[model samples]
Structure formats: C-alpha cells, structure tokens
Target: MTFTLATWNINSVRLREELVCKLMTEEAPDVICLQECKSPVEKIPVERFQALGYTHMVARGQKGYNGVAILSRLPITDAGGRDFVQMGHARHVAARLDNGVTIHNFYIPAGGDEPDREVNEKFGQKLDFLTEMRDLFHADKPQRSILVGDLNIAPREDDVWDHKKLLKVVSHTPIEVEHLVETQGAGGWVDVTRADIPDGRLYSWWSYRAKEWDEADKGRRLDHIWATSDIASAGHGSRVLRAARGWTQPSDHAPVFATFDL
Candidate 1:
C-alpha cells in the first residue's frame, strides 16, 4: 500500500481551518499529523474536517495550548502511550492504521527564549524531554514507525538561511543540535525529508518576526519527518510547502510531506 502523510504546525487550528480545508482539497494526503492545534479536543471543529472526508481522528489537546492531532481517511486506532519523559502537556499522540503503519505525532517543547536551562525552566524541560525520548527509543526501538512534528530545531547549517548568524540562537544552539542527533540516532530513524532534498537548503519554518521574511528568507528546519530504516526506501516525494507561508493569514510554519510505499 502506498500512502502520503503530511505534518504541519498550524499555530492555531481554529484560525486556520480554512487553510486546512484547502490542503485537504489540494494535497489530499492519506494522513495529516498536526501540532500546536491550540484547542481542546471537543472544540477542534472535527466536523469541518469530517466533511472533507477525514472522518477519523485522535488528538491530545488542552485549552489554548500545545496540542497534537492526527486525521486520516483510513481506519486508525489511537495508540496512546505515557509521554513519561515529557508528561503534563498535550504534546503527543500516536495512531496505528489498518495498513500496519504507526504514526507518532508530536509538538516538542519550544524551549523558551534563553537557551540556558539554569535561567529558563522551559529550557530544562525541553532537554529533559529530549533525554526521555532518547531513552525510550533505545529501550523499545520503535519499528515500522514514522515520526513527524514541529521539532523546533534546525540541526543542519544548511537548514537555516543564515547559518552563521544563527549559531547562538536557541534553535541552532550546539547543545540542542547534539540532543536532537542523539535522540533520533537512538531511535535508528532515517530523515526522510533530508534524504529527498539532500543538497539545497530546505526549511519548514520562517519567523513571523521578520520585516521581510520572504525577502530575507531567514528560516529554520523546525519541522521534520522520520521513518525507521526498515522501510526507509519507501519514503519519497518529500517536500516542504513553502508557498503556504505566503498565504493570507498564514502560519509561520509550512507543512512537510512524504509518501511511503509500504
């Protein structure tokens, strides 16, 4: 079976429901994993999505905060788990499709302004979250799994428009890069998006802070799609929908896509 999956940080789903509907009509991915939904499960406007043929969904949500949701046209079972390392937030959810593919959706903490854990408690929590995920992946070793989300880090120098300038920035800080590498390595996951766009710079997020974000084009690879090596070859057609950033009332981030021939 071949299916396409997309991951996006919608910022606030309520504010972008029209964009979501547009994506459904245009891209028509089999499964759509979203982060930062910023709404409770009951208030997610599921009927709007349901009308678009994504009749199934599994979401972990809180009022006006971090939320993760998965909507699929295919049959899916909520594969819930204790986000033990990063509990107390609506930041993770998983679903198993009838095709035997497990999709892990996440919205990892956006470790506050200061990168120093000593100064910022959120920074400490972010590090702890990464550490916990690393330990869990090593212990259980997720198989036949595809993980996707707004990871909030740009690990590679090429991923940013101004890599040299962003060295001290939170997302590109050396410590955060090291942790991201360590965690994903422990999971034995393949960077599906990078595998497809190997040479040129690719990014899924541009700051809304920029005076001319598109003109200046200072962006980060905050979002990602990864797969276990077992079916790595099946992942292709990877793309970062950058044009969406130009849309009226757009999210600071764009969606990333990948297709799997499983």
Candidate 2:
C-alpha cells in the first residue's frame, strides 16, 4: 500500500475548518494528522470533514487548549494514546491503518520562554514529556510505525533561520536538542523529511510575530515526521506546504508531507 500523509498544527480546527477542507480538496493526502485542535472531541465538527470524505477519525481533545486528531480516508482503528509527564493534556493520539501501520500524532508541550527548568515549570514539563517519550519508545520498541506532529524542538542547527541566535531560544536550546535526540534514538526512528531533503535550511513553522513572515523568513523546523528504521527507506516525497501559511487567517504552521510505499 502507498499513502501520502501530512501533519499540521491547525491552531484551532473549528476556526480553520475551511483551511482543513481546502487542504483536503487541494492536496488530498490519504491521511492527515492534526495537532492543537483546541476543541472538545464532540465539538470538532466532524460532519464538515466527513462531508469532505475524511470519515475516519481518532481524536483526543480538550476545551480550549491542546488536542490531537487523525483523519483518514483510509480505514483505521483507534490505537490509543498517552498522557506524558502526567500533564493530563490532549497532546497525543494514535491509530492503526488497515495495512498495519500505526501512526502517532503528537502536540508536544512548548517549553515556555525561559530555558531554565528552575525558573520555568513549562520547561520542566517539556523535558519530562520528552523523557517519557524516550522511555516509552525504548520499552515498546516500535516497528512499522510513524510519528508525526509539532514536536516543539528544532534539533538541527540548520533547522533554525539563525542557529547562533536561536541557540539560547526555547526551541533550539541545547538541552531540548539533546532530549529530542535521545527520544529518536530510543525509538530507533528515522527522520523522513531530513532523509528526503538532506541539505537545506528547511522550516515548517514561521512565527505569526513576524510583520511580513515571508519577507523576514524567520522560521523553525519544529514539526516533524519519523518512521521506524525498518520502513524508513520506503518514505519519500517529503515537503513542507509553506504557501499554506499565507492562506486567509492561516495558522503559524504549514503542513508537512511524506509519501510512503509499503
């Protein structure tokens, strides 16, 4: 089976339902994993998506905060989720496709402005969340699985517009990078996007703070897609839909895509 998958942080699905439908109409990926849905599962407005042919969905949501959902045209069964760091946030969900591929959609906690855990509790939570992820993946030893979402960390120097300037920043701090590396190692996961586009200043998220985001071009590769090593080679056609950021009332994030032949 071959499928195209996309991961995006829609910010708020209800507010951006039109954008979601537009992507479904335009890009038509076989499956899309969404983060930061910001609505209860019951209030997700599934009918709108179902009308667009994405009838299958597995979602974990909250009232006005973090949420994650997987919408698929292809059949999938709920594979469950986790409450990492015991934060009790709707930050993760998983589903298994008919072909036995398990997809995990995540919305990792964004460590606050300060990098020091002593000064910032959110930073501590973020580190703890990554630790839980590393522990879980190491214990379970995932295979034929893909993990996608706004991981909230940019591990590579090139993943940031100005690496030196961002080194002290929350997303690109050395500690966060180390945690992410350990998590990837624990899962034995391969970064599908980097594998496909090995050399470049790639980014999937541009801050809305920029007055002219496109012209300023300050961005970070906080979103990611990863596959277990066994099937990593089958992944290709990786891309970030940057133009979507310019859409009407767009989210700061742009969808990241990867196609797989399994």
Candidate 3:
C-alpha cells in the first residue's frame, strides 16, 4: 500500500478551518497530522474535513492551547495519547492505520523566549517533555511507527536559516537540539524529510513577526516527519508546501509531506 502523510502546526484549527480544507482539497494527503489546534476536540469542526474524505480522526485537544490531531482518509483507530511533562496539556495523540502503521502526533512546548530553564518555567517544561519522550522510547522501542508534529526544535545546523546567529535562540540552542536528537536516537527514528531532501537550508516555519516572511527568508525547520528505522526506507518524496504559508491569514507554518510505499 502507498500512502502520503503531512504535518503542520495549524496554530488554531478553528480559525484556519478554511485553510485546512483548502489543503485537503489541493494536496489530498492520505493522512495529515495537525498541532496547536487551540480548540476542544468536540469543537474541531471535523465535519468539513470528514466531508473531504478524512473520515477518521484521533485527537487530544484543550480549550485554547496545545492540541494535536490526526485526520486520515484511510481508516484509523485511536492508539493512545500522552500529557508529557505532566503539564496537563493536550500535546500528543496516536492512531493506528488499518495497514498496521502507527502514527504519533505531538506538539512539543515551544520553550519560550528564554533558553535558560532556571529563568523560564516553560523552557524547563520543554526540556522535561523531551526527556520523557526519550525515556519512553527507550523503555518501549517502536516499529512500523511514524512520528510527526511541530517538535519545536531545529536539530540540524542547516535546519535554521542562519545556524550560528540562531544558536542562542530558544529553538536552535544547543541544549534543546541535544534533547531532540537524544529522543530521536532513543526511538531509532529516521528523519524521513532529511533522508529524502538530504541537503539544503530547509524550513517549515517562518515567524509571523517577519514583515515579509518570504523575502526575509528567516525560518526554521520546527516541524518534522520521522519513521522507525525498520520502515525508514519505505519513506520518500519529502517536501514542504511553502506556498501554504502565504495563504490568507495562514498559520506561521507550512505543511511538510512525505510519501511512503509500504
């Protein structure tokens, strides 16, 4: 079976309902994972998405904060979810496809402006969340699993527009990058996006603060698509739909996509 999957930090799914549907209508990914939904699951406006053939959904949502959801055209069953760091946030969810592939959707904390945990509680929470993920993967290794979401950290130097200039920034800081790499290693996950693209300054998110996000081109690869090494080779054709960021009242992030022939 062949399926295509995409991940995006939708910011507020309710506010961007039209954009979501637009993506579904244009891209038609077999499955799409969304983060930062900022709405209760019941209020997710899934009817429209369902109408687009995304009849299956597995989500964890909160009132106006961190939330994650996986919408699939193919049948899927809820596997589970987690509240990493015990922050009481709806940050994670999982679903199992009929083809036996498991998909994990996560919205890791953005860590705040300050990189120092001692000075910022949010930064500390982000670190703790990543630690828990690493430990969890170590305890229970995953296979035939694909993990996607706005992981919040840009691990590779090339992931940021200017790695050296952003090294001190919260997302590109060495410490945060280390934590993310550790988690990926623990899970034996292959970065499917990088594996396919291989090189270049790739980015999935551009700050809304930018006067002209495209011309300035200051961005980071905060979102990711990862698969367990066992199925890594099956993944290919990874790309970011950069045009989505230019959509009307668009999310700061563009969707990242990968196709897998299983």
Q: What's model 1's TM-score?
A: 0.98
Cα RMSD of all models vs. native, in order, equals 1.0, 0.5, 0.6
lDDT of 3 by residue, 20-57 (tens): 99999999999999999999999999999999999999
What TM-score fits each model? 0.98, 0.99, 0.99
Q: Name the lDDT of candidate 3.
A: 0.96
Candidate 2 residues lying further than 4 Å off, grouped into runs, are none
Question: Which 10-residue window in model 2 sums to the lowest lDDT?
Answer: 81-90
Model 2 vs. true fold: TM? 0.99
lDDT value, candidate 2, whole model: 0.96
Q: Between prediction 1 and prediction 2, which has the larger TM-score?
A: 2
Colliding residue pairs in candidate 1: none
How well does candidate 3 match the true structure, expressed as C-alpha RMSD?
0.6
Single out the weakest 10-residue window by summed lDDT for candidate 1: 81-90
Error at 78, model 1, angstroms:
0.2
